[model samples]
Each structure stands twice: as structure tokens, then as C-alpha cells.
Target: MSADIPATYTAARPAATAEVSRQAWLVWLTSERRAARLTVETYGRDLAGFLGFLTRHLGAEPTLADLARLTPADFRGWLAEAAADNLSNATRAKKLSAVKSFLRYVERDHGIAVAAIGLVATPRARKPLPRALTVIDARAIATEIGEVSDVAALQARDTALFTLLYGCGLRISEALSLDRGQAPLPGSDAPLRVMGKGGKTRIVPVLPLAREMMARWVALHWQPAGDAPLFLGARGKRLDAAIAQKSLRTFRRQNGLPEHATPHALRHSFATHLLAQGADLRAIQDLLGHASLSTTQRYTEVDTAQLMAVWRRSHPRA
Candidate 1:
């Protein structure tokens, strides 16, 4: 039997209308609602993709009626296609959220009601448990930094970096993005200013050891001009994220820690250890810069495990 001939598919391109798209984007930015820049950018991109899809698949610009005609089943089909193409649930949810927001914006700004767009529900994702290093393992990894004798400055930098990660629960990106000009010395009782996600900034207290390590490194390699990368690479460039991960992996393997040991694990350890020591959930939420209390509640699950272990050991009814 002869194989069936493949059908050719042709995508339609919409005529360029830069003016309309630009006006829409500008309105999104200047609107009184005060959305985050990242959110605006993300929604803009998602809406553009949907518009492109309409032109490509249906050979016409998408009218409000066109969007209104879509069923939840149709949206689910699109989401399935995205998943089949290897998109993560987080990415899919972001895109769907963007589409929903855009639909709302069109209704409010242009007086076009596309009710069907609201039917697309985002996929639910389970929040993974935070991975953390044990206190002994964290100290052990720090000790191995001293073994890198060939690069004494790097030893101090790595020690301080890891110390801040576990000590203050800083994301690796936040720690590396620090500049020398931004308050070299954090006061003994004060919190260090850290730039977090979506350009939001937060204050995190410094551990004495972390502070000492940072001060010593600064004094030895300190340049009077405060406008340089806080942590420099061997070539005097800003340290890259990959290098930080590689260093952590090497230290974990050398010190016999679990394979899951990562820079993020230090953050998890910081929260977990704090919860064990009776830190309030709300305070932990503030420290982590979580937008929702439910996000901070996950750490309590870590605390629960610890509580169960103590109960088993101390209870006489066992």
C-alpha cells in the first residue's frame, strides 16, 4: 500500500499595525491600576502570541467576537498543544493569566466584551518542598572553601557567598547582583538591602559570621571606589550564576552532602532552621518576600516533620 500524501499547511500573516499594538501597550503601562512591570511585559507578549495565532490559524485579525466564540474546550486544546511542545506548567499558567488580563483590558479600554476568554482556567501545580542542607553539612561545605589555597581571594568570596545564602536566605541572583557602593557595612542590628523578584527590594539581617567574612574580604581586596561587582570572577568580571552552582556542587560532593545540595538549598535551610527555632510564620513570609501567606506555610510542613520526630522520641505511650 502507498503511504498517504502529507497535507501542506500554510500560515497566514496579519498586516502590520504597529500603531494599534503600541497604543494598547502604552495604555497598559500608564493605567491607574499600577501593575508590575514584569506583569505588563509578560501579558503584552502573551497577547501578541494569541493575536499571531489568530492570524496564522484563521487567516484574519481576531475580533472580539472571534475570541467570544472560543469554548473552554478550545482553550484546553491550545494548552495541551503548549504542554506537548514541552512548556512547563508555570509558563503555561503565566501565558493564560496574561491572556485573561488582556481580555479584561480590552473590555475596559475598548468596550469589547469577550466573555469566553475568561473560561480558560490555568493548570494547577503542586509547590515542591524546599530542599535544605543540614546545619552540620552547611558548616562542612564552608570548611572546604579554605582548601582552595591557590585562590585565596576566591576562598573568602565563596565563604561569604555561601554564608549569606544559608545565613540570610538570599537567592543566588540577589547576592551576586550586589554592588560595593550599596552600603559595604551592614550595621550589627540592621538588615541588608536586597533586590528581589520583579524589581522589589527587601531587607535581610546579616549573620555575624557572614558579616565578618564579608568585612575581611573587603578589607583585603577592598578598592576605595565603591562602584564594582561585590563578588568578582577570576578575570575581575562579575561572578556568573553557573560558577556559583558549580562551586556549591563541588563543595557538596567533597564534603559528602546529598546530591540535592544547591544554592537554593541554603535558602530552604535558613527558613527551616528559623521555623525550628520558633520564628513566626508571618515574619518568615516577610523575610522570604512571599506575596501570600500560603507560600510561607510550606515551611511549616518542614517544621511539622521535626515536631513528629521529637514527639516519637519523647512520648512515653509509644
Candidate 2:
């Protein structure tokens, strides 16, 4: 929970000796692989854990040669050690993923065979359903956000941002990255073009309420340029996603909402509410910009569960 990143201590230089390959792998992961900083740190720890186990099992430090010569038994031993240490299935799976990724890189770049790594079975972990807010709670949260402050720009900005999320089913990143032209939510009833994950562009209809809120925010715009950022921070810079998330976190705390009331929940609520109203599954998938219909299918399960709950509450055959 500290402000300092845990991996800062583990950050090291690539040496010309035994650590040369590990450092090279780290460098490639960061530079070319486009891996996040946290990924580099956690993957580094997983590798370190693997090497530490190898040292105890083989009575020495593992060199690149030792890694290339590693057998399936060595990997099984490492997995067994992780299991004995009571690592959760999720943690174990992540560690295994890191190892596999590193070995895959070694195989491709260093010409080292990673057949043993490929044989390792990934640990199965349960996937939790995304927590979505109820329609009343989602609307209440949005209404409450606008009243949080007296500043017109801040109030309008928060209101517009939350409305875009619930009304349009946009990801936080997609919403935050919006320029005025890219996500023009004001003065238009047409579909707004949104660039989602993997550079896929999808056009989503703009709700009238969201458009009205956006009109309020744009009036206080500093530049009034078409291409300027739609949302601005305290200093008039493009709004940081954390600021919006923190605002929601504070709102949830103040209103006695559940812990799962996050910024992303608004998007989930958009989908769940639509599905509950008898929207087509495929249409919901397209509206939410989901590439796979299966991802959108989760809302069906949520709706069905809600239906069963309602039936139980209202049924006379108790």
C-alpha cells in the first residue's frame, strides 16, 4: 500500500557474467515487448524464485546453459515447491505464465529449446464475474457526482464522464483518451466513434442526458478547440484516469455503496441493464464493442440470476 513501488528494490543492471541473459530478457520485455513496468518486476520475481529453487535443488546458481539443459523434472520440482509453499492457484498460474513467457523468448531469440516449459500445465483458476451496480445505484452515483463540488467545470466534467461511461459503455482508458473530435458527446445525437482495445474503432449512440452534461462542460472549456481534450484535470491538462477512479471511490465511501462500485462498474451496468430489458445478446455484444460474443454472454447469466431471485421473492409457492 506504500507509495513506493515494490520492484524498485529489485531493479538491477545486466551484468556480462551469469546474469547477462536474465538482464537481456528484462530489457527486451520492457523495450520491444511493450510490457508494463509492474510486469517486468513481477516476472523478475518469478524468475528469481525459479532460480532460487534451482540453486537449492542443484547445489549451484543456474547459468544460461543450465537453463537450456533444464528437464521437465526440474520444472515439476519448481511447481511442487510452489504448491508446498501454499501459493494460490492464481499466483501459481501467474508465476507459470511468467516462466513460460521468458522461456518462449529464450527459445525464439537465444535459440534455446523450451520444450520443457511448454509441457508445464497452467493451473486453473476461477474467473469471478465483474461486479455491476444496480440501475438505481448507478443513476444515484452519477447524480451524486455532479453535486460533490461547487465548481461548475468540475461538476460538469464528473457528470459528463460518468454519463459517458453508463450511457455509452466505454472503458476508462477509452473515455480518458478522448479528444473533442474523437469523442464529441455534445450537440449530437449520432453515434460517437470510440477507439477501444487493440485499436478497434466502434461507433456507439450518445444518450441525450450525456450530451446535455457534455454541453455544460464544453462551455467552460479553456481552448474551445475541436481537437482539444474533452475532459481536463485541475490544471486544465487531459484528465488522468486515476482522478475519475478516486472520485468514484470517494463517492462510494460517502454514500454507503458496496466496495465494488468502481468506475468500470458503470459500463457493466450499461450492459446488464440492457440485457435485463430483453436486448438481443448479439446487439449487446456489438454495442459494448466486444470482439467475442462469449464475453457479452456473461450478462445473460447475470440477468438470469436476477430473474431467479425476483421469482423467488414474488412466487406464492414458498
Candidate 3:
């Protein structure tokens, strides 16, 4: 949370003491909720914004007692104030959500139910579809990344990385976090364990083609065993994702692929391609390590569009 808005109450100890519950709730979010770093950071900022407003609005530190008596009008005033400060509806909505969550925590931990917060509704926002590459384009990009590099080792490393992006459906961070011990033996069919968002681990089945490429790359490169990084920078440290992103960016630009041709685009293509092949949404969710099935269902939209395109192009009735 930004420290700028402390507009602190004169009774510093009272204010600070009253804030202990918030800290405890944050700890619960970390340990029990397993909230992502960005989620925790955003929630903290939203709560800080609310508390800062209360300091100004109430002319005193807000206690749990103060929170309990807040009417719907008080909530509306807070949203209105945030709007006057030019916070977008999306941001105001997020702030309200954080405040609501904090109050719910207070209710659970301290028996102070701020049920009024439930009356506030979130602002609706348009959801965008995931951008996915066509199967041909995804394969072409991976093949080019492997073959087009100047150095043999670098070529092999990049090939393995891109292959994982497409073949294993790994997020760039997940793929780059791989170590030497993760390299499956040639022709081995064991599943690869990937630690994804929010520190959740999921097992991903390795395609034989992906395994072959990975084994061949390991054979041609350094760090085949022990705990060194599976992919390396020029200095031989664990590879930075920016380098991988840059490599993809350069390849896309040269190959005339769309600008969205990113490492993540490979992952989008992974799920979309799977959905196109009639894979179950639940299975894809498991492979992508998504906590919500709705997140995986976005690929259905992509697949539907592709099906429409094929129908338009190939059907005689069209």
C-alpha cells in the first residue's frame, strides 16, 4: 500500500491498534487463500485507499465499531469520492470489492459483520477473448525459433522453451522456472509437473514429440543434470522471461505473424487447439492449471469462431 495517504488520526496508537485485524486478515489471505502476489498487493492498496478516506471523512481513526454503523450512503460517498479523483469505474469496483472482503474478514474473525457492503454491486466490464495462434502458425513459430538461431546451444534451448510453450501449454514463467532435473529422458512418457499461478502445481502430460525435442536439446546443451536451470542466459543463470519474450517478438516480426504472437499466445493456442480437437473443458482447465473453469471456457469462444470460419470457407451453401 502507498504510504502517502496516512492522514493519520491524532491518537496514533488507537488507529494503529485498530488496524491489527486487517493485518491478520492479510496473513490469512497469504497462507489460507494462497492469493497471488499481485492480488494481495492490489487488495492492500484498495484497503489503504478506503482507510485513508475514512481518516478524512470521520475526522478520527476508524474502529471496527465505526465500520459497523456505516450506512449504504457512506459506501456510495466513498465510491463517489474515488470517481471525483478520476478513478475509473473498474478501479472503483475493485476498491469496493477489497473493502467488502476486508469487512467480511472482520465479521468472521472479530464477529463484526459489515453486511451492508454486500449491497454494493460491482461495475460490469467487457471481457476480452484469449488470442490464440492457429496450429500451423504455432508449430511454424516453434520450428523457426529452434532452427533460426546462430548458436547451436542457444538454438536448442530456445527450441525446447518454445516447444514447452506450445506442446506442454506452459506459461512463460512456468517454463523458464524449469531446472535440469526436470528434463525427462528420451522416449520417457512421464508427466511434467508445472507450478503455475498462485503457487499451484499441476501435472502436464508431455507429448512424445515434445519429449524428443527436449531430450535432444538437453543432449546438445549444458545443464543436463543436477539443479542448474533447464534454460540458461548467456551468463548461464536461470533464463529471464524477457529474453524469451524478446526472442518470440523478433521471430513474429520477421515472420509477419500478428503482433499478439507472444509466448502466452502459444499457451492460448495450446488450449484453443485442444478445444478444437474436442478435448473436454475440464481437462484443459487442469492442464492450464486454472482454478476456474470459466477461465478455460474462453477457448470455447475461440473454437466457435474457428468453426464458423471453416463453415464459411468450405460449405457449399455459403
TM of each candidate vs. truth = 0.58, 0.62, 0.61
Model 1 Cα lDDT, one tens digit per residue, 183-225: 3354566678888998888888777778887876676567666
Residue 71 of candidate 3: its Cα lDDT?
83
Q: Write the per-residue lDDT of candidate 2 for residues 1-318, one digit (tens) a residue.
A: 355645432232121223566678899989998999998998888987887888888787766567776788889888888889998778889998888887777667555665778677788885766678889999987666876677888998999899889888999898988887655555566788888888999989888888887778777774657688888999878999999998888888888888989889988999999988888999989888999998998888878777798899999994
> lDDT for every model?
0.73, 0.81, 0.82
Error of 1 at 234 (Å): 0.6
Residue pairs in clash, model 3: none
lDDT of 3 by residue, 1-318 (tens): 356545432222233334666677788899999999889888887887888788788897788778887888788888989889988778888888888888887766666777677787776554778999988899988777865579988888888789888998899999988888988657677899888889999999988777777877888765546788888888878889999888888888888889999999999999999888889999999999999998898899988888899999999998
Judged by lDDT, which candidate is best? 3
- lDDT ranking from best candidate downward: 3, 2, 1
Clash pairs, candidate 1, are none
Best by TM-score: 2
Show the lowest summed lDDT stretch of 10 residues, model 2: 8-17
Model 1 C-alpha lDDT versus the unseen true structure: 0.73
